[model samples]
Target: MHMGKSYQVSAKVDEGMLASALGSGDVGVLATPVMLSLMEQAACACVQDCLKEGETTVGAQIDLAHISAVPAGMEITATAEIIKIEGKKVLFKIFCEDREGIVGKGTHLRLIVNRDKFQQRAAAKVK
Candidate 1:
């Protein structure tokens, strides 16, 4: 995948995405985990068209900071840029923003993997 590739994904915060509903916290605001999931979605979109069939990227690490709380009903956008690629690992710089301004920022790492192989390994664990 080419460096500097970027993608953006957005979602409207709802009750199901709230920190209180997610059990991450007791506040009636957007959850940190939801923000992280959006960031991961943007990152995946950045490289999705480049992946071969049966290949996918799995999140490996996330170093993010939720700087501000977003209340439900606000629209949030997450943007990710491919900053580095090393072997099978890809690094992305990501950030989340609301109508006011940036709400979170951080880096995330994902590793390219064969989907069937990864699923097979995961299934084996239950057997």
Candidate 2:
């Protein structure tokens, strides 16, 4: 996808998504890993339309800060904007917010790959 293209994905925090429930922390709130998944979900949607059939994007790296805690039952939205594209690599600026304001922000890197080929490579690792 070209630079500046953007997309958003939202999710409601629940007991299953909490830090205590996910075992990421002792406190009851949104977990960092879950927040990052939402961010990656947004990034994937942002470039879905640009991919050819049998192609998909996989997360390569993520650098983010979970700046605030979102308790259960609150909805949060993550927005991803394409900041740069280098060959098969795509870089995105990500922001996650709750009803009040921003809760997280960071950058993510994704690499485009043929879906079947990528799956095959991963499956080969089990052999």
Candidate 3:
């Protein structure tokens, strides 16, 4: 993947994305896990066009801080920019924002893998 390239994904906060609905908290704001998923979705989009057939990236790690609460009906955008690439390990600077301002920021790491192989390995765990 090329360093500095970025991608964004946006979604409106809904009842299902709320902390109360997701069981992450008792409040009605956005859930941290959902925000992280958005970040990961943006990260995946960043390098999707560059991957070869059967190759895909998986989230390896994340360090995030949710600084603001976003209520349902608000739109939030998550951006992921490639900061570093070491072999198949890609590091991204991630951010989440609403119309008010930044709601979260962090770093995320993704590892490139063969999709079929990864799926097979995961399925084998149940056998």
Candidate 4:
């Protein structure tokens, strides 16, 4: 099994967007900035899918740029590919596109962690 794999994620882009230069005021269909979230989630899933026996996955870092402002009600798709693997740590590259063109790109890192201990440590971080 390999950690650096690829996956396709479907998305809904917003429509009717406008730039700040236009004072009249029309805003693009605001979305939850799905690209970043999708990229991270895909990396996590890939790490989990490729984990060997007794291994678990956890997200470590994600560097992404949301380049395009998609209007409300449009559709988009983001693709993620794992680029490197170091033992329990995996690196991925993600790209996103909508009807207009490329919207975002970035690299992400995920680490295989002990499930029980990971959860405990995460819960403790919430001060």
Candidate 5:
């Protein structure tokens, strides 16, 4: 796969469910999943971008830093860029910016493999 490719992704949060006093939530913990979803999307898109050139590494892991908070109703966007390559493994630098500000930033690691087989192996590992 070719290097230096980038991908963009976005998501909006529902403010009503993010309030601290609401029966189901706490603000800090609530937005974490939103940031994670963006990261996952960005990482996946980056992998797809790489595949356009040729079959390349896929996401194996992610290291994320949630530095800012996003209230409900705000949208978050993530951009992932390929930074390095090691054989079948790829390294990406991910940044997430939202209506509030930079909500999260991270480094993601990916490795390539047959998709269907990967899922089967992953399921077996859980058991």
Candidate 6:
């Protein structure tokens, strides 16, 4: 994928996405894990159209910070931009926000892999 390519996705905070429900913390605000997942989703969408057949990306690393608490029912957006690509590794700059302002920001890494080969590797672990 080309550098500077980006994608954005939006979601409404729900009870199931709360920190308390996700077991990330005791508070009822949006969970950090959920925000990270959304960021990953945006990153995936950013490069999906550019992938070759049978190729998919898997998250390899994330360095993110949750800066504010978002209560349930609020809408939030996650945006991911492709900042760098090195061989099969892709780096992204990610940010999340609500109507108020930015609530999270950081970087993420994903590795492009053959879907069947990756699944075979994963399946081998159970054997």
lDDT of each: 0.96, 0.95, 0.97, 0.68, 0.71, 0.97
lDDT, candidate 2, 8-49, per-residue tens: 999999999999998999899999999999999999999999
TM-scores for every candidate against the unseen true structure = 0.96, 0.96, 0.97, 0.74, 0.75, 0.97
lDDT of the structure predicted as candidate 4: 0.68
Instruction: Give stretches of model 6 more than 4 Å off.
Output: none
Clash pairs (backbone) in predicted model 1 = none
User: Candidate 5 on 4-96: residue-level lDDT in tens?
Assistant: 788898767665435363544465333565566677677777777446333444557888887876666677688988888887778888888
Model 4, clash count? 8
What clash pairs does model 4 have? Answer: 13-74, 14-71, 14-72, 14-73, 15-71, 15-72, 17-28, 29-72
Q: List the residue pairs that clash in candidate 5.
A: 15-72, 57-112, 58-111, 58-112
Comparing 1 and 5 by lDDT, which wins? 1
List the candidate numbers ranked by lDDT, top first.
3, 6, 1, 2, 5, 4
Summing lDDT over every window of 10 consecutive residues in candidate 3, give the lowest-scoring window.
Answer: 53-62
Relative to the true structure, candidate 3 reaches a TM of 0.97
Between prediction 2 and prediction 4, the one with superior lDDT is 2
Q: Which stretches of model 5 miss by more than 4 angstroms?
A: 15-25, 28-30, 52-58, 123-127
1-127: candidate 6 lDDT, tens digit per residue: 7999999999999999999998999999999999999999999999999999999999999999999999999999999999999999999999999999999999999999999999999999997
lDDT for model 1, on a 0 to 1 scale? 0.96
Looking at candidate 6, what is the lDDT of residue 46? 97
| Models sorted by TM-score, best on top | 6, 3, 1, 2, 5, 4
lDDT of 1 by residue, 1-84 (tens): 888999999999999999999899999999999999999999999999999999999999999999999999999999999999
Error of 6 at 60 (Å): 0.6
